[model samples]
Target: MYAPQEDTELLAGALVEEPVPPGADVLDVGTGSGALAVTAARRGSRVTAVDVSWRAVCATRLNALRAGVPVRVRQGNLFDPVRGRSFDLILANPPYVPAPDGRGRPRGAARAWDAGGDGRLVLDRICREAPALLRPGGVVLLVQSALSGPEQTLGRLRTAGMKAAVTRRRRIAFGPVLRDREVWLRERGLLPAADNEEELVVVRAELPV
Candidate 1:
């Protein structure tokens, strides 16, 4: 639901540069709408897109067909469907909304967009498990928000034994998630009425060879 041009552009640029090299395997975790996976497939990577939502998985399949790219779309949580498999590159736009009480998400797409109590649940899991799924010299590209603590995400990657860096960042207008959270925070006096800025952070990390 928070799909944006910056997300698409970042994936496009990464694929254009062939970050995984030719004939490498790539994984698009949380491939909502299949944008990154499809783009990577078009660039000749053997791509697999994974999502927990059946609707998302179906949408990705339909989108791949429309794009004429043979991307493998799987319905599973995170890396569950591809256990024991490793990829040369991994890309993710995980749900990072901080839902302290787990009430911020709608029932249908909660798994797709909710990150548990602190909004870092999915991200933390990804960081913890990604190293095992990455091939030697493999890289992981993750996009998250400042609301989720950009520095903390980077730190998680480093703690997971990956060489991490913030590859790109941009000031994004308040979307629905942010707007809703702002309202909630405002009601509790946690956020001031004058603050309305949001930032998106894109991080790239490499698994050691």
Candidate 2:
């Protein structure tokens, strides 16, 4: 089975080093395999992980148990399951793949990987809704792709009235999504004649008091 990737691990480690107040409540949006939620719980945060996929929710629960941490895993879209709920910290590794057609997402798509066209569908919603779900002085951690550009994500957060910054970044090898595309393009003679490397952009943004 396809499992949680290294970017998830990197995002978890980044959250561990951030200033999370003791016993802070944390929400892990799009907790695909629950890696980040488990890490936050193990670090003493009260964590709730939300995913739209039943499989993801189950995976998160099992992963949390394996990690010996208690995390509430919920199944719902975005913040729907936790409406009226606010948290001290929110972490999300949302789907941000920009589709080639330049159109919106299709129905019943993979919530963890498909980001619709321009790869900003999920990121955009998170930015717009996060402020309403965050406590004063809360912080949000987001890990997306450079395909959508770092500034674009930051701009959304700023427009949402949150102070945002890029705290950490590391180049990651292109995963299956990009790999398949590269193969298709090569077969069609559309790929560049030279070597190419794809990278992911992991960013952390905070909401000020």
Q: CA shift at 196, candidate 1, in angstroms?
A: 1.3
Cα-based TM-score, every candidate: 0.89, 0.88
The C-alpha lDDT values of all candidates are 0.79, 0.80
Candidate 1 colliding pairs: none
Clashes of each: 0, 1
Candidate 2 local lDDT, residue 85: 92
List the lowest-lDDT window of 10 residues for candidate 2: 184-193
Ten consecutive residues with minimal summed lDDT in candidate 1?
Answer: 1-10
Instruction: Kindly provide the TM-score of model 1 when superposed on the true structure, using C-alpha atoms.
Output: 0.89
The whole-model C-alpha lDDT of candidate 2 against the native structure comes to 0.80
Cα RMSD of all models vs. native, in order, equals 2.5, 3.1
Off by over 4 Å in 1: 1-8, 100-106, 186-194
lDDT of 2 by residue, 1-209 (tens): 12677668768778989888768999999888888898888889999999888888899999998888999999999899999999999999888765556344644545567676567888888888988899999988888766666798898889888888887777767777777666654554434446475556667777777
- How many clashing pairs does model 2 include? 1
